[model samples]
Each structure stands twice: as structure tokens, then as C-alpha cells.
Target: MFIGRQHELIALQRMYDSKRFEMMVIYGRRRVGKTALIDHFLDGKTALYFTARQQNSRLILQSFAMAIAAYFNQPEVDFRSWDNAIDYLVSQARRHAGDKLVIVLDEFPYAAEAEPSLPSILQIAIDHGLKDTNTMLILSGSNQGFMESKVLGVHSPLYGRRTGQIKLQPFDCFDAARFVEHCTAEDAVRYYATFGGTPYYLAQLDPQLSYEQNVAMLCFDQAGLLYEEPMMMLREELKSPAIYDSILQAVSNGCNTPKIIADHIGLEPTSVSFYLKTLEELRLIERSIPFGEKPTSRKSRIHIKDPFFAYWYRFVAPNVTLIETGSGVEIARKTAESAVFATYVGQQFETMCMQWIFRAFRSGKLPLMPVLTGKWWGNNPLKREETDIDVVAAEPDEKKILLGECKWRNTVNETEMIASLRDRIGLIRGYRETTLAFFTKNPVHETTLAKYRNDPDMIFVCADDMFRER
Candidate 1:
């Protein structure tokens, strides 16, 4: 079930084998697989794993004690308080002499919120107690703000104490594809664009169903997991869930300007700005001005950073009434009717292909080093100010650009797509060393395949190639 993250796994193993006290902090948005990764890596190891709750420290201590008793086969072990519980945990870790004891505190932010002094206490234990006891401590959470402030920030008591940290992210295109029971990389990209790389979301998908069908079941159905997921997620993470929902809807509808969103939600811009900052910190929303620019740039646009939230707000939440009253088939029909969704997902699909292009180029699977890669939007290539390449890769020094056109269709003729790529490049202002590459969900035309005939610069990649044909 573990796919990709070979690098992270290796790094984690190396840290564990360092023969000293170690601390790892892993945090990310909900369902990004932080806990899963830890669980997967430490499956059979001697580890004390506990999820923090919103209760008082005393209650949390009791829960931890219970877990320890269960794990150690001593149901009657008594711990009077949080401090005692932690002391015992450190003692047990020291007694386990072979390998280091792995202790994971999932949702540590919740515990810190419940007890402000928890971090100081943890720092004491890590510094005075566990330093030479061979313990690997992991603190993971979904509340990025709380985690940063209490544990990872410079002013925090626990800052600079962690040996390793991972901001667990969603699976990239290639990794997500591996979760597909039976689907092509093209299908996986579509899935990733909509549900995002969240393991929980991808795991819920039915491989036998098409993307639309899966959406119908999971989003349109009133009892589905995602039917009210946004609401639940916000309520869990923010104090003002309704206001946050309004702001999120505004962003999803393209009201990226601060004034526009505030006006739409009937809130003051300053107040809305506070919520926006929180969203940005949590990685739920992002402010972007094209790609490279200052954070306060005038053209900056606020957008939902997570694809699933974007898709839900744009498609499912907007049409909630219809979905609530309509049949499943009607919902699916309506979803399919939106061709614009394809264009949206197509752009993301194209980006994923670009990543593979860069990876292949880096690995020498393809010829040439692509120095610059991005989509040219307002800077159109055509004279009529229409038609831009879906993806472009260039070697600025060589004055060479590789033009690519992505087709998510069932079948693609490489020659025709490449021909279109050639035409699209005409609008690029500074074009130098030009190469041709095609990324298609469907197989390329046979004649075009024959024409390339092992050409280095002229290359084609299908959905299968993106996932290493696994």
C-alpha cells in the first residue's frame, strides 16, 4: 500500500539507526498520510503510539496509561498524572535495550492546546530524561499553526529539539497512480486533480468505477464520505467554521481579491484577511500572483490549495440542493455535462506530465536539460492572441524550447498533436532550440511513432510511462 516516498522512508530509517535519541515532527493537512507513513515504517517495532485528544491533560494521561498497559500486557499499571505517565514511558523506553523505542504522539497540537505547558514538559523529558535513553519521539498533527507555534517555531520551548521533521504532503501524480486498483496514469491524474493526493480520499475510490461514477457515489450521495467533508474539516480546524466556509466558497468562485471576497461574504476586509492568513498557514488556501512575485503583489489571487476542497466547493457544494433532491444518475449526468471540469483537470494533468518530463530529462531518459518550464498564459504565441502550449520546457542558454500539447482524449495521433505543438510555439516571443514532445492519455498515432523512430529530442509519453508502467 506504500507507494513513492522512497526517499523519506530511507531518511527515516537512517535517523532511527543513528544510535542516539531522536525526535521527528510530522504534520500536514488532514488525510495526507502522516500517521500512515509512521505506522507503515514502524509496523513490528516496539513503539508507543498515542493520539492526543481535546480533553484536559489529566484525562489524556489516563488514556496514555491505558494504552501503555494494553501494549505492555500489564492492564493494572497505574499512572497518577501526566508527568508520571511521561516518566514511566521514558523508563520503559530505556528498559527496551536492543533498538530505540519509537514513541509517536499523533495530533500533538490538540494536546498542546489542551495544556499550554505540555511542550515545556516534553522539552524537560527530552532534554533531561530521554537524551541518552535511545528514544525516537514523533509529534504529528493537522493544526499547522499550533504545531509551528508550540513545537517548531523559534520561540517555542521544543524548537531545535527535533532531529527530523516532515511536512507530510499528498502523493504526487506517480504515487497516486499506484493506488488505482486498475487505471492508467491519465485516469490517476484526473483522480488526483479532483480528490487530490490524500490517501484517505484515494482509498475510498472504487477502481471498477469511472471517475465520474466514483464522484457520484462519494460526493453526490447524501450519505457519502465527502458529502459534508468540507464542513467537518473546517469545524475541526477553525473556530468560526461558517465564516471559514463562506470565505472558502468565495475563493472557489474566483473571488481571489480581498475586497471582492469580503464584499461577497458581507464581512470587513480586515477580518476576512485574518481568516485568509489562517487558511494559508494550514495549507488549505494559497495566495498566488502567477508564480513568482511578492506576497502583497496587486495581482495576487487567493485559491484553495487543496484540489479536493476546490473541486468540492466549485462543483458539489454549489449544487448541493440539486444533489440532495436528485437521483444518483441525474447527479452523474450533471457532473459529466460540465466540460469545463475537463479543462480544469486537463491543465493539472498537463502539469503532472511536465513533472515527469523534467524527471525523465534529469534521469537521462530524455535528451536535454530543461532549464525553464511553465505554462505561458497571457503571453500567447499566436497572432490572434489565442492558443498557448499546455506545457513548455526550455534550455535558455541554448535558446531552445520544447513545446508540448496534452490530450486527455481516448486516442491521440502524435503527428497531429506535435503539428499543433509546432503551431503553438509560433507565438512564443523568444524561441530558440526547439524540441517536440507529446503527452497523451491515449496512445500516439502509429505513423508518428514510426516517424520519431528513436529520435532523442522528439519524444512521446503515454499515461503508462508516467507510472513506470507498474
Candidate 2:
């Protein structure tokens, strides 16, 4: 079941329809559906696909030669070097002049790692011959650093040669809900909060089972597919898995600041900053400041960007010993009934509400468009304590802002919550008009609804409304 990515498919189709020389670079993290998108686009098209493996240069050259041979129906052909392989490709492009011929190198980094001179060789070929032919070239990889620095960076040999590029992202909350369409809207949110928007992970869920059953089978059981997924990904991507594991563990324990994380992991603050930067580059962690504050503010906080990783480190990593000792079912039951788990999901729900606001603004369903939107937290000097707003949005002129609160519980005190949100309005200045928004898991009471029904500035969005088609 292919769910979303209509935009990506349209982009690829536009390039293919041009019938001219083109090079598109596609890259993202592993299991992000890059290959799936390519395969779906290539259906019923004339193309030559080769997936590079971690092997010697000679073996990779031989494999490339075989694919070319098979594509052209000349099985007896062989190429001994990268130069010969590239030359043959250029010759074929010239022979099929004006005809669209796509050549995809999936996992191109593995081939480049084996033969360091491959990019320069390809660059020379592109300049000398391939540019005049109707050949569409695609280079895809999973290593974010290598793809950025070695393939797309300013100093790279292939820099300025690519006609297009795409950094594919995970699905948003609305698109991800399609995976379990039969489940309730609330259960769908919980599933998303657990498995996240990764297509590979979401495909493992069974909608027929309850949320607890699915969570236990896929996460807690020793023989489950995702039992050691985080550890395996770390080992594959990082040089020192143990140090990275310790760093992730520290961040998962609410050590959001550099000094606190360094203290938790027993590392120097400077060294910890380096690792945090790398994690940000890999899209595993994110760093942000208050919405209204400057980018260089000292109140910056770090968070785990991937929801599945956050859940794994918080629950599975801490209880691995007991899980492996055949107590996974009991532990899973306890985890489902724990207040900490509810709090964690509530935090995720706040993020989902922010996403819904952005989508609504794009579709013109809101009263005003926002130029800036994010969560806000700071010291309320009047109250002599720290305070935070779940969702904040400012208009282009900064004369109007939207302040919102998200509730992920069974019931809420509508009047009291509204009064508290009204009190925090004074914390922000320079806004002539303030719009109030509330997102809840359930509907508000009749009395509360009647109180605000005549007010145009009050916006009420419930879980069902969020799940509706935009």
C-alpha cells in the first residue's frame, strides 16, 4: 500500500517528460522509502537499475558490466575498469540519441567508497559526451554526510552538475494515519506516537490487534523485529556505537542542555556538542530555542526528533534485562498503564497539533496565516516561575498571534483552561489582536461550547476534525 508522496512522484515525472539529459540526486535515512518511490516511478519504463554493495572495486565493476550487458542483450560483454564502464554508458546514450534512458545507481556511496575516483570519472564523462544525449541519471544513497559533502557540496567533483535533488522526509500525522484506517482516531494517534511515520516500521503493525498487543509484539518481545533496531542503526552509522548510545540515553532522560547531558554521560561539554551536531545532521536529534527568542539564545534545548527512538530509549532500553528474561508481557502491561507513558504521548500530541495548524493554514481553513509557528517557553517574571505555551503563531506583521493549548486526556476543564490561556496572553506583546485556539481529544461540554459559540476569535479543533480530509 503506497500511501503518500504524490509531490515526489510528480517531480520525477516532470523530469522524465523533458526527454533531455538530467541528473537527480535522492537521499535520506535508511528505510525511508527512497527505493520504493523510484521503483513505482520506473514501472513500464525503459531503465537500467544497479544496486551497489559493500565490495571490492573490481567486483563492483564486474557487476556493473553485467547489468549493462543484460540491458543491451549482449551477455558476452565484460568491462575491466570504471573508465570502460562509463565509456560504454556514454556510447549507449549516443546510440539511443533523443530517447529517454534512465540509469539508477542505488546506494551510490558504497561504489564511491570502494572506488574513490568514480565521481571524477563520471564528471569527466558527463562533460565530454553524456550531456548531449537524452539520458536520465539518478544517484541515491542512505548516508546523509557522504551524499551532502561528497556528492552535493561545493567542493565536490559532481557539484553543480545535478539538475535536481530531493531530501525525502517522513510522512506527516495525517498521511501516516492511512496505515491503520480501521482504528479509531485516538488509536491512530497513539500508533503514530509509537511507530512514528516511518513506512517500514508502520507496515509491521496489525490493525486487528489492540494497541497494547501490537506494542508488546513488535517492541517488547525478544524475538520481535524492532527489539534491537536502535542499537543496530547506531552500529551501522556511527564509528563508536557505545558513546553514541550513552549520549542518546542521556537525552532520553530529559537532559536537554549541553551541561546537563555532558554531566549525565560523563563527557566534556565541548565534546558533547560535537556529537549533538552530528546527530542533528543525521536528523536523529533536533535543537531549538523559544519561538520568540533569537536563534543564538542560550536557552536552546535538544530533543530526540524521531518518535520511535524516543519511545525505545525511554521504555525498551531501560527494561531490556527483564524483557530478555521472559517478562516482556508483564512489563508491556505495566507500561501501558503507567502515567509516565501517558505524559510522553501527550507531549507527542502537542507536536501533532502543531502539524495540524500548519496544514490548516495551508488549506485556508484558518482566520489568519502565520509567518512563524512553534512552542514557546520562558521565565514569567510576574509569576516568578517558568511557563510554556503548547502552540504559538505570529502573523506576518506581528500585530496578531494565535495562542493554543492541547489536551490529550479523557476530560478537560474547558473554562479553567481558557482562563489560564487568557492570563498568559500578557506574556507576549506587540500584538493588537489575539486569537485563541484549543485542541482536545474529546469534545467540550455544552455549556462551554455555548459560552464561546458567538465568538469569532475562538477556534475549536478536536481529534475527529484533525483526522478529516484536508
Candidate with top lDDT is 2
Mark the 10 consecutive residues where model 1 has the least summed lDDT: 288-297
Of candidate 2, the 10-residue stretch with the lowest lDDT total is 72-81
Q: Residue by residue across 1-470, what tens digits does model 1's lDDT show?
A: 67677777887888788789999888887877887888888877767789988888778777888888877778756677667777877778778788877888999987888778778888888888898887888899988887777889999999989988888888767677777847756567778888887888888988788878888889888988888998998988789999999999998888988899999999999899899988888777877553223446686767787778888888888788887886755766666667877767775677688778877886787656777666544444344565556677777676777777788776565556676676665466566567777887766777777878777667777777677654
- Model 2 residue pairs with clashes: none
Q: Cα RMSD (Å) per model?
A: 3.4, 1.6
Q: Report the CA-based lDDT of candidate 2 relative to the real structure.
A: 0.88
TM-score on alpha carbons, each prediction: 0.86, 0.96
lDDT (tens digit, per residue) of candidate 2 on 1-470? 88889989998888898867899999998888899999988988978899999999998888888889889888746687899899999998899855588999999999999999999998998999888888899999999899999999998899988999999888887888898888888887888788888888888888788888998998999998988989998888888888888988999999998899999989999998888888888778899888888889899999998888888999999999999999998888899889988888888898889889889898887777878888888878777889889999889585888999999898998888898788788687678888989999988888888989999889888888899772
Cα deviation of 456, candidate 1, in Å: 3.8
